[model samples]
Target chain A: MNAIVTVLRKEVRDTLRDRRAVLSSLAGALFGPALFAVFMNFTVERTIDEGEAAIEIPVVNAADAPNLVGYLGQHLIEAKEAAFDSREELRASVRRGETEVGLVIDKQFGTALGEGKAARVWIVADRANASAQTAVARVRGALRSYSSLVGVLRLQLRGVDPGVARPLAILNDDVSTPSGRSVLLLGAFTYFLLFACFLGGLHVAVDSTAGERERGSLEPLLTLPVSRGALVAGKFAATAFFMAVALIIGIAAFAVAVDYLPLAEVSMDADLGLVECAMAFAVLVPIAVLGAGLLNAVTAFTKSFKEAQSYSGIAMLLPTLPILLIILNPMQPTISMMLVPSLSQHLLITSIVKAESIDPLYFAVSATSTVAIGALFGLLAVWRYRSEKLLV
Target chain B: MIEAEGLTKRFGDVVAMDDVSFRADDGRVTGLVGPNGAGKSTTLRVLCTVIKADSGRARVDGVDVAARPLDVRRQIGALPHLSGLYPNLSARENIAYYAEMQGMPRREAGRATRTVIDRLGIGDLSDRRAKGFSHGQSIRVALARALVHRPQTVILDEPTNGLDVVATRALRDVILDLRRDGRCVLFSSHVMQEVAMLCDELLIISEGRVAISGTPDEILRETGCGDLEDAFVAAISSERESK
Candidate 1:
């Protein structure tokens, strides 16, 4: 244990002196949170701005749809005359994002409405365009209200009760809280957090192991009186320490950055506070250890700095696997999911974000199992260090 | 004292060391002389307990290397074929790390580091990062690390392989100082004049076997050679002919 501390200090000192390693580690910590903030701010702000803006519907023949335009105007949708040389030109305008939707009323539309017959109006817009789709919905809604009113008036004129036209009234009750609805975003957030933990120690672990080998230092180091297990443990401690620090920094940055995000505009009530950050740090401890151990174990097999770097590059993608699985096959958390290390941490972090009180038993199982697996990898690293092939 | 008996090591089909055995007594400098690929490095590595021999028993201060390798390591300070220094750390830090690895407390390691730095006359270079160190400076740091623990036996592989005359003389003086302090010093060199100048005893290895082992004068008389170089060639050539 004393030897482990010694080695840890030495590893830290050596790696910290490397400016590239220091700068890269710091960048890893800041990457996830800074990106999340930018995405959230842009999306939430755009959604809010788009929601408050008036819906613009461009009609080719404004005279033919006077009543319909008036009805749409009453519904706060702006009905405007559209100018185009041809039908294709109008369609091109909508596709070019110059107009949200275009309306083309038949020449006989007034004749049809006067005779109490069907009227044909085509709503032209790209369904794939988000703003166009929303504008099309608003236009359809206004048309439906106008159509319903006309039907009521026609029924009264026929000396029948208009209420008899609809015998049933339907309503929907939605009970999902904003927190409950933002689970996907929170899951993604947790994924990046765990990823940061894995990457924080990557360079250091590779530097201390394979980098040492490439520099011709491992042989002398191994020849010391220290036990291979102790040496590995020491390296693991340094890696985990740096990883935890990096993870904490990432969480703090995320928390601070999230404060300026307009999540309330989008009705997402996620506020990553101090308590949440602390919980994230606590839950991620085992994964950080596991990540460090895994990196060390893999890099110890590599013969050079470049080989170790490529290997660790592959390892960085491992944390995201469980998150991807969760997305592809979404499932409610069971006790069994908590037994898998990264998966369990993901589930726990997601639950934390949802403001749901997790089962202590689940947290215990997750923490203990993850740490146990990490310790197993640490032992494997020790075994690798002990091998004679390590010297070669 | 350090001893190896019937030590054999192989890499695939090639034998690195074949039944090599020798002893270096305390208070004397034992020079391991060999041509290239004579297994001097392999033998030192096995003795350092970094690489295991296929079949043999090696000991430092009577502790078996294979069975009690940690104990053997504790008794020996080994400078392997590589000058393994952390380029980012200062010389003092590199040496101090080894002292701490040997189980010394931080303060004690610091003290020992100071003593080793002073003894090596590397005070000017000790605080600078090893990346910019000259070859002699780097070797001095590695040597400081090896001797920081003050082990019972010192083992070095080609300690003077690339050193200039001044650095070589300094290294020889350190070896003599170790002998004066009653420590067993075992080092390998291909330079015949170096071996002739410093070795109280010599082990000339050829084809992974000890071609001859005795004092330099004794080997010269035995081969009826002009000097240590002729004796070394005669010894290895005779061993090669017999094989």
Candidate 2:
């Protein structure tokens, strides 16, 4: 036990003295929260602005449909006279993305309305353009409303009830809460946290195993009086310490960064207060052991520091695999899923962000199973250290 | 004291050590001299308990290397062929780290570290990080790290591979001091002059087998050569002829 502590203290001091390693480890912690804040804020702001802003669309023959243009103005959709003389020109401009949406009124529109016949009009738009879809929908809705109003007037003139034209009315009632709606966006937040946790221990894990061997220090170290198991345990503990530190920093940064997002403008709530941050830290910290163990085990197989680094870069992605899988195919939290390491942490953290109740049994199973796998990896590292080929 | 009996190790089809046996007593410096790839390093590794022999028995200070490696390691201080130091740690911290691993308390390890640093007369180099140290400076610090525990047996695999005149003389003095303190010292070398100048007992190994071993005068008389270098060559040739 004493030897483990001694090795841990020495490794920590050694890594701290290396300015480059320390910076690389902690940089991930800050990067995740900063990106989360900037991206989410921009998205929310754009969505809110798109809803209330008025849009302007060009019309090919404004003189042919003055009354239709006047009716569109009431819905905050302004119509401007097109510079082009033909409908083809309007269609070309919309296709080239110079205009979001355009209108082409038929020459006989007024005569058709007088005869009580269906008028011809074209709403020219590129449906493939995501930005133009909203504009197209708004213009189409205004035209449909104008047609319905004309129908109602024509029926009233005949002494018929307009309500008879619409037999039933459909209404949408959404039951999702504001916090629950934010869970999908905040799923990315859990990914960042897990990535930072893995990155924190990468340097120490590579340094203690492959770095020592490359430096030719492992041979002399093995000749010491201490058991190989104690040595491995100490190195693993140091890696875990760095990983936990990164987890804490990431959680704290997210908690503060979430406050700056315009979530209220979009009617979304992120439960990232101090209490939630603490809960997230609790749920995510157990994965650090698994990360440290996995890194150490992978690095032990490599012969040099550079080789270890390349392998560890791939190894760190293992825990994040569960996060990606869960994101792509979201599943309800179950006790069986809680047995997986990163997936469980992601689920528990998502629940914390959504302000949902968590089962204590899930937490217990996740922590224990994750730690058990970590210990197994740790033992594998120790066993490798004991091999005669380690010196080679 | 160190002893090996019929020690043999093989890596697949390559035979590294072939029935090698030798003994180095306390209070004397024993030199294992051979050409390159003569299994000098492999033998030292086995004796230090860093590796095990496939079919042999080796002991350090009367402790079996295979049965209780930790006990064997406790009695020996080894300097491998490539002695490397942690670049981020100072010389003192590196030595103290080993001292602590040797089961010393924090305060005691610090004291031992300072004592070893002073004994080597490398006070100026103790406080600086090892990143920029030259080859000779690195070897000196590595030697200090090995000796901080004051083990009963010292094993070095080519300790003077790369050293200037002054550094070589300093290392020679340190080896003499170990002999004066009555600790068993076993070192390997490919250079004939180094072994002649310092070794009290010499073993000439060639092709994974000991060609000859005795006092310098005894080897010279046995090979019928006037000089130690000629005797070394003659013994190696005769061993090859016999094989």
Candidate 3:
């Protein structure tokens, strides 16, 4: 449509108008990927060096927990120990970025075990750092083994057989899918893409309608003999094109980031090629349609420039839902559940990372559903244009 | 020419326009004057095809507005109390956009845009952004956009809501020129004096219904006012007193 081209031009022109929009979008998308590359590269080398050396970690002292401290030094050729007075003080240290971790033992540890009860210790550290958390798990494992050994020695000292005391010893092994090894990787990439979509189309839609309203130029456009449908189509098409451009930048960010995920101990395939990259972009088309259509609909119904932005806040939240959900839980990707907006693309992306074959039917349905929803919203927006109350 | 029969618009049980009807002839500026919340903009928007009436038959040049909005739209132009330029685009781009929207060819839009830019005396600033322009400049741009397609009728909803004398007079001249070209022009304004000075015919609306419709001379003689503004105040008060 001629209107669609005009709308597209307006959308593109608006993007070219703002410097901050481009920088901010690329920042959200690029920060994670670029950071991941630098982090993984630095961490991998540092971890390899640490893997070859005996490392020192601080332990908070609690009275009568001698055996627990001894257990942590077993696998090392050398041990250098530091002391903290209290667990809370150690947590404060971690919070203040003074140390990566602080190991703490409770005061009641020996007393509880003497009375044959469970005793616990805390690993105080910044949860945001994955390396610190992994190290804390290793420290916990060493302490647990030491505690059980002491319990068995105590049972033998009381003249009961150690074998009889250990009758119900349980061993836990993790059973999880190899296909979803990079679920968090998928989420991180998805968040980047959502950020891309938002920043990409945002300027275009705002400038096209609300910007027009704010500057008092909406009258001339509406007064012309063109149908409101044509006007909306023009705006919607334009906004979507910009969204797609942002998406491309986002996908590039993901590609860059995924190249550097440690994928540690998972044997996950590092096999994403150019074809898969192109397919990932293709799946984004429907979402592009939805973003553009929804933006126009919100901006048009708003009375002023400020009001339109408040309405578009709903847009800012919608794309991030899938990302937030996956990041919180370990998600199993399925093709059948494609109705969840950005999650569908997330599934396809995990497949790319693990080198699993992507289902063609699933991607086809995903693009279809996104475009269909876009069309539904487009019709609602067009109906609003005919509304007397809305324009005035 | 424009005609309406039993035009009524309702929001819930409250009727804004209840069985109101009036007609206006071609080649003159017909003023629709009322205070705020008087349904003046509503009438103009309905005529511009920006909105629809709940129940009524309204037509521009015998084209049913509801039934053939696109057809009726092709015949009418309006500036509804606001400028409608795309902010990012230059003034020429904004005008060219509307002209294109009206199905004008590129060369035709170019010619018309240049002519209106010259005629409205905004030629020097046609390449500037509309967003940062002065109110008067924006109004001139809006008027240029409206007249660029040369439609058969023009309806403006309070076009002079915010303008200085220079812009207001320029708008009045543009309306007069439209009348001289034999195109029917309808505009609503709260400033009764400007309406009285510029409009040859008048429609006084109160509570969405046309309370009085006549020429400026006829309304003045009928209401016994020295001018059209006093005639409007008298007619509006008279309509309220009767109710």
Candidate 4:
């Protein structure tokens, strides 16, 4: 145990002194939170702007549908009269980005309405254009409202009850809170946190294992009187220590960045307070250990530092798989998910962000399973280091 | 004392060491001499307990290598062909690290590091990081690291392979000092002159087998040669002809 501590101290000192390793690990911690802040800021500002922005529609004929135009004006959709010699010009204008939406009223619309026959009105828009699509919805809604108003008046004039046309009333009651809707946003932050834990110890893992081999230090170090198990334990401890540090920093940065965003305006709240951040760190400690052990074990088998680095780069992507799966197809966290280490930590993290209290059993299962996996990898590393082939 | 009996090692079909056997007594310097690819390094590695012999019983100070490797490692100070110094660590730190690994307490390790550095006349360079050290300086640090734990047996593979005249002389003095302190020293070298100058005894290997084993003068007398160099060539050639 003392030997392990000594080796751990040496490894930690060596890696911390390397400016490049320290900076790269911190890059994820700082960048993830700052990116989340920027994204939330953009979404909130865009939502508020969209609510106040007016829709503009270009109409080919304004005199034919005075009532239809009056209804649109009341809804803040301005009908700009455009002079076009042909209907093709109106559609061409919409296609050429000259207008977001265009409307054409048939010339026989008044004659048809007076004869009690259906009249045709066409709304021209480029569906691929987002603004044009939104404008088309607004124009269609206004025309429907005007047509209903005229039908109600006609029913009243015919001495029939206008209420007979109405059949049923429907109501929408939403139970989801602002925090509940922010799970996707918070999931991204959690993904970054997990990445930090996985990659934080990578440089040290590769440096102490394959780097030592390439530098010819492995044979000398192995020849010392210390047990191979102690040496590996020390290295694993140092690696997990760094990984946990990165996790803490990542979570803290996320808390500060998330707290700065004005999410209440958009009915979303990340609510990354002190207690929540602490809970997240607590939940992920075992995952950090698992990541460090697995990486070190893999690197121990590699022949050279470059090869180890390439291998570890692929290993770092392991955490992303679970996060991507959840993002692409979200599922509710179940007790069974707690048995998988990364998935468990992710679910726990999401729960923390949503201000939901998680089951203590889930935390216990996550920690125990992850630590068991980490120990398995650590034992493999020790066995490898003990082999005669290790010197090769 | 260091002893190996019938040490045989093979890598797939190539025999690295075949029926190799030798002994180096306490308070004497034993030189392992052979041409390139003659299994000198392989024999040294087996003795150091870094690699096990497929079929052999080796011991350092009466402790069997295979049965008690850590105990054997504790009694042996091993130096490979390369110095294997950490470029980022100072000479004192490197020596102290090995001392600690040998189970010495931190304070005791510090004292041992200082003693070895002073004995090697490297006190001036002891605090400087190895990155900027000269080849000779790094070799001195490596030697200090090896002796820091006060091992009963010292095994160095090609310690003078790349040293210049002055560095070689310095290394020879250190090996002689180890002998004076009653420690068994076994080192490998291809340079006949180096083996002839410092070794109290010699083991010449050829084609993974021992071709000759004796003192320099004894080898010369037995081979009917004038000098140690001709005696080595004659012994190797005779061994080849017999095979």
By DockQ, the best candidate is 1
lDDT of 1 at A276: 85
True contacts recovered per prediction: 0.88, 0.85, 0.68, 0.65
After superposing candidate 1 on the true structure, give the runs of residues whose Cα lies further than 4 Å from its correct spot.
A85-88, A95-100, A157-159
TM-score for each prediction? 0.96, 0.97, 0.78, 0.93
lDDT of 4 by residue, A1-392 (tens): 77998899888877877888999889866778888889878977877665557767777777787877888888888777766645688889888988777788888888877776777888888889985665678688878887878778878988988888866656898887789888866778778888777778888899999999998888888788788899899899999999999999998888888878888877888887788888989999998789878988999999999999999889888767887887788888888888787888888888888889989998999889989998998999999998887776
Model 1 scores what on Cα lDDT?
0.87
- Which lDDT tens digits does candidate 2 get at residues A47-121? 876667877889878888899999999888888876668899998998899989989999999999888899899
Candidate 1 lDDT, B152-194, residue by residue in tens = 8999999997999999899999999999999999999999999
Residue-wise C-alpha lDDT for candidate 3, range A264-283, written one tens digit per residue: 53433344457767877887
All models: lDDT? Answer: 0.87, 0.91, 0.75, 0.86
Which interface RMSD does candidate 4 score? 1.1
TM-score of the second chain in each model?
Answer: 0.98, 0.98, 0.95, 0.98
Candidate that would win on TM-score: 2
Per residue, candidate 4 scores C-alpha lDDT tens digits across B1-243 of 988999999988989899999999999999999889999988988888788999988989999988998899999899887888877788888888889888898999999999999889999988888879888888889988999988889999899978889999999999998999999999999999989999999999998999999998889989999998999999889877887
- Between candidates 1 and 2, the one scoring higher on DockQ is 1
Where does candidate 2 chain A have its weakest 10-residue lDDT segment? A46-55
Tell me the spans in candidate 3 whose CA falls farther than 4 Å from its real position: A19-24, A31-46, A56-76, A79-186, A206-220, A257-273, A297-304, A319-335
Winner on lDDT (1 vs 3): 1
**lDDT tens readout by residue for model 3, B87-191:** 567899878877877877778888988988988889877999876888788878887888787888888878888899888888888889889999999888888
Judged by DockQ cut-offs, the docking class of candidate 3 is acceptable
